[model samples]
Target: MSQDSTVVCVVCGGPAGEPVYASDRECSITSLCEVVPSPTVVRFCQACGHVQTTEMPGIEAYYDTQYKILIESEEEDQLYAMSNGQKVYRLDHQARTLLRKLTPSAAARILDYGSAKGGTLKRLLAERGDLRVHLFDVSAMYLPFWKAFLDEGRWATYRPPAAWRGTFDIITSFFSLEHVARPREMMAEIASLLKPGGTFYGIVPNTFTNIADFVVIDHVNHFSAASLAFLLRASGFGNIDIDEHAHTSAFVVTATAAVQQGTVAGIPRSEIARLGSEVERIAAYWRNFSSCVREFEDGRTGRPAAIYGSGFYGTFIASCLSRPLDIRCFVDQNPFRQGRRLLDRPIIAPEALPEEIGTVYVGLNPVLARAEIAKVACWSGRRLDHFLP
Candidate 1:
């Protein structure tokens, strides 16, 4: 991004719209990995209603080293893992949903791009035994799982551009495109990877649907429904359909590669402005959130406190707390993280929390924060304003 030239939208080659938020790069919530400190800049494009960061560093390194830590730990990272068995349920349900919409062929080639741990592909394989499934991901640490999950010679790491041109009937990416800085090029690559008239199904966070997604630093692309439609259409895709009901923060999309060039739908100015306003509103909410955290810590420095939800938000709260020793532990429901420690504090189950614990800051996503706190039987009817607000 040169000062002389305007930044272009990642989805559409439109003028970089408006700056919505600026701050230091936050810690990775998905992988719980440390990131190099840099100024974070989030902008929204008025032409396409796509929100993106202007500063995107080497993402490959982020995934290979920092992101791979979660894989090596055998916990699969919070990014891939879901709460309350929802990971399996979500994957199986999405696979079944997609299979229901498509006319399955006797021998269909399906590629799960960014197939972390090959879990999604595994479910798809079990459900559609006749399909030829393949996996692709940035982190090759999951390579070992492929042999057991898929047939031999079905997994791949980084490949040259268009290496498998026109080879698959379906190419799917779940929560992958938003991490890429060059989304337009990614769309083009997706188009090239699929056979003519092949379906490209993807799921990405809808920032408006879940405001917490708007704050995640790693998600460079904050796509609205309109922008996603534009991206697919601009990438020579047709018949784009979005299912917003699949996940709270996700948009499940199905599109087909066009045989020839086609026109794309442009977002209305009013809609783009509305999306930009949403960016502003989320930024304000976070500002108030940070302030509330600071106010709580100002005089209650010696209280025994813990953070609920050991994912990104919890990690972020821990980073903000001045008296780290006051933070006794982290409360998480993930069985894999129960006995583990994060940021030098033990991650305990809700039942394991000490009765003397003064405050338990809810670090879960905003959408689930209230409900998660309500589940703690020990804290029932307790004054939890300091913990949740």
Candidate 2:
């Protein structure tokens, strides 16, 4: 858990300043089931107010061959929310948000960089048939899914063709930056791929909003507003807009590729100190999370329980348990995850959960855990104890 002084900030190329959080426990990846037991150390850059983790070994190979996100089926998607008793999926919401933010002109050339399965772009194309869309990613595992909507010429693996350089009007990345160890390099490539005055739109996790991101091992860079600005400016982007509240636990950003490289501004000392303090507070939370969960379990030993989400939080809860066998199943509202298995426990819908289970661990975002759990009408009259994060 020692800090590597040679590690530089991905945004500003400054030395990694100080260690903020370090852990030796098994950490979960974005693809919930994958776990890394190696020690994790997070460092904060004083110059740019950026927080980043030590890169995972063989991270490139891992993402290319091992990482598997929502690839079960073409219809599978993460649950965004429950709108008036209707299930709203994530891709649909993302498409709506992007369209509202930037409406492309007819026949505009657009590419979804690091676009796994190109779900968001597929949804967008369905709305605007005149827009020309392309897909790019490191892995070819999702090529089958992309083939359904895009022609072979419109998609590429490893890297896009040289002919694609400076040809795109719009480039979008959806929750891909955090996983990359060299974000600055990635941004430079994105800039080269765009025409002058072209826009780069992206969504990255906001660790300050979603504390779980602080401990996710696969997320190499944990971006702050200041760090994001630095990244875009250093990569020759201008007219940048970063909106934190546009999406839950994410930052929505749009930056235009400038004809000339933009000047990088120095962060204020006061702001650096403020960000450092905030990062320390979040680190302390994860340091004590396991102990808190253990204490909660101690009070209800021998009682059968269920986890209320099949994502990262739920997997983390199971990892912290003293007797994981006590948990009978995982309850999820998303139909895609209902029939799956996490930690050898069946993931069932709320209505399908056995009535004998007396306790429920709400393994969801702490900011929305309680309210989401309450929305399940099936658990209304049942005398079940709920452990909320």
Across residues 96-203, which tens digit of lDDT does each residue of candidate 2 receive? Answer: 999999979889999999999899999999999988999999999998999898877999999889999999999999999999988988999999999989999999
Q: Which stretches of candidate 1 lie over 4 Å from their true place?
A: 1-5, 24-35, 73-90, 100-103, 160-163, 299-301, 381-386
How would you encode candidate 1's per-residue C-alpha lDDT over 245-306 as one tens digit per residue? 86556898999985577677678888877877777888777657666777788856365888
TM-scores of the models, in the given order? 0.89, 0.97
Runs of candidate 2 with Cα error greater than 4 angstroms are: 26-31
lDDT of 2 at 68: 80
Give the lDDT of residue 134 in candidate 2.
97
lDDT of each: 0.74, 0.89
**Cα displacement (Å) at residue 151, model 1:** 2.8
